[model samples]
Target: MNEQQENKPLISLQNVTKTYGEKTVVDDLSLDISEGEFVTILGESGCGKSTLLKIINGLITPESGSVSVNGQKIATPAPAESKLVKLRRDIGYAVQGSVLFPHLDVAQNIGFVLTLDKKSKPEIAEAVERARKIAGVEKELLTRLPGQLSGGQAQRVGIARSIAARPKLLLMDEPFGAVDEITRRSLQDELSRIVKQEALTCLFVTHDTAEALKLGSKVLILKTGKIEQYDTPEKITQQPATPYVNTLVNR
Candidate 1:
């Protein structure tokens, strides 16, 4: 880690709250993610796990609260900050569906960000090569449609596109949830390796106990719009914070 990264939080949430007309969704939730730290938010359905990632991505804004990236408080993204535009140019987000455009091919999808930055053609080609090597994207698959991809292949493309800009933090919403068991396992292992190699801070969301345990150095368990437990995955798995947490893990 560099000196700047050591001193700065890649992502910080303070007193974040989101609500509809009558119901609060996420309430006063605060968290910090340091560079290279993988933090997982684990929760049951409707527990606001996905909401937190959206807030970080700036897709959904909080009615009241603040999010700072690289020491700068960010407002909602603008058109100038297109999908290719990194919200902070430091956080990369991957969603659950990972819906790739049916019309675009793998290289085209991965090259999307480079084009937005208006990088030269040579630079885009070089970056694409690196992305493919790092993400293990096959050459032949580059021209194939999303319709032709296996679940794992599609997920790999989604992740590769997210990392093409080389963001310091990755915000993922159950990136592995849709794949089959074997593919999911493979991706998780591959992602762990990539996280270490890239030294990337990641805030990933998942409801699966084992998934959280496998990916996170620390896990935050959310229940009904509140954090019920925040600790290492082993700590949560071995030492439940409450009866509710115990039931969730044990069951």
Candidate 2:
């Protein structure tokens, strides 16, 4: 309890629920995520972790309840003005199999968001270059089309592009899914370093327990639309809340 009180939560979900037809993917779900924290939502294929992320980002609306960020009540599909606009500007979302413009290369993809922000040409160029540097994107790769880039390279491009917006919260769904094991490990380490250095508040969703344990400061096991367990990675492993959680970690 004392340990839980340490970080100041930046987002809180209260009595959040979502339903599709007869199925309840997330039911009366609630959570609190601290500022500058990395919280991973782990579950099986049909669980609502991914959907929850979309809801938080206002890509999807909940059937009931509220999602608040930094004490402001977030309207569903948030208004595209002022703080909401700025909040949208500050939150980054990344996904596996993320679509990249076939016509665009690394530099172009990273520059797209900057262009939308009405930044100066030099500012856009500088941001694009910095993002590329942070993602370890090669100068040569910047010239190559997305089709020419490998899976790992494409993923890095996606990461660089997402961060270029300077989002305060990052929502990632299986961002390492397409990469090979070696590249996945390298990317994971790099991401952890980047998130820590930037004081990013991140919500990552993965079906893999290893991935959850490796990346999450807090790991929440969601069963359908509900959180079955929420704890530190070590605590979740050492003292699972249910037989299913133990089985998952053990497996």
| Best candidate, lDDT | 2
Q: How do the residues 1-251 of candidate 1 rate in per-residue lDDT, one tens digit apiece?
A: 67875867777888888887888889998877777788889989999988888777767778777887667666433224464245555445444347887898888888777887799999988888787878888889899998999999998888888778777777788888788999999899888888889888888899998888888988899997888998887888789999888987777
Quantify all predictions' global Cα lDDT against the true fold.
0.80, 0.82
Clashes of each: 0, 4
TM-scores, all candidates, are 0.89, 0.91
In model 1, where do residues sit more than 4 Å from their true spots? 1-8, 75-87, 90-97
Question: Which residue pairs clash within candidate 1?
Answer: none
Best by TM-score: 2
Model 2 compared with the native: what TM-score? 0.91
